[model samples]
Target: MDLVTLTVDVVIALWVVAVVVGIVRAIKARPPRLAPLPEQIRNRFEVGWERISGRFLYEPQWAVGEADSLVMSLLSARGQPLDHARLPREMQQARHDAAAAANGRPRDKTEAMRQVLLQYRTVFERNLGPKPRRTAPVPRREVA
Candidate 1:
């Protein structure tokens, strides 16, 4: 065969091989499996928050501890990217503050605890969509 014809045939063969490989890959490809929060775990989160807000609202130390636990659980479940070490560092500091407060440190760390809660909430909301609204139904009065 002529040189030009031979080159054309080789290019055609390479194109065919590439097409076959692509088709095989497409056929074998599978979507990534997301680890969604299980219903039971979600229930635990709701209950934990309710307890913190209802009974521990005035107790800054307790509230921050509970919120921190919830945030950590969420991050663990969602498999958050750990490329930057900042988040973990912040979490560790928050945990230490909570411990200090729990041990009855002389200085009041309520403000620091509140900041931790705020940061935890921001992270939680960013990872898991918006938080569901928690509201009580109003009672309707019977008209005479």
Candidate 2:
């Protein structure tokens, strides 16, 4: 529109942008408590809500659990035919055989299946580890 109107609008927009950026930077920096009202208040406004929600939500958690299950199933094979429960068991066996054809060396069928499983194993290896033992030291004898 007119120059006066556009300049006022530009000033207001600049002020709004400055406020937003200042707020974000304050949250990230966690400014000193000695500062005055607004800046001090801004320091407490931490932001990681999205990341916290992502890990806890149903779909993400379920997918992570499935990756864990796949790893467990593969490790159980350990280069042998897994004694899987029957029914689509025959079909799964055939699928493993077909996949072996694609690999340069013809892998043992179980190893072929385990390779598929290694994708999930990598996830388990990265994310989870065994719990530490609660080892208490034995009491020292008081010599006579």
Find the candidate with the highest TM-score and give its number: 1
Model 1 CA lDDT for position 77: 74
For candidate 2, lDDT tens digit of each residue in 1-144? 999999999999999999999999877555223222233222222122223224433443333344444433433322223334321233344345435534535435334444434444443343233433558999999999
lDDT of 1 by residue, 1-144 (tens): 999999999999999999999999876453223366766676677677677656455887768877877877776776654333434556666666666666664465665666667666665665554445668899899999
Task: Mark the 10 consecutive residues where model 1 has the least summed lDDT.
Answer: 80-89
| Cα RMSDs, all models | 9.9, 20.0
Candidate lDDT values, in order: 0.66, 0.42
TM-score of each: 0.46, 0.27
- TM-score, candidate 2, is 0.27
* 48: Cα error in model 2, Å: 33
Q: For model 1, what is the C-alpha lDDT against the true structure?
A: 0.66
Best by lDDT: 1
Task: List candidate 1 segments past 4 Å from native.
Answer: 1-34, 81-108, 130-144
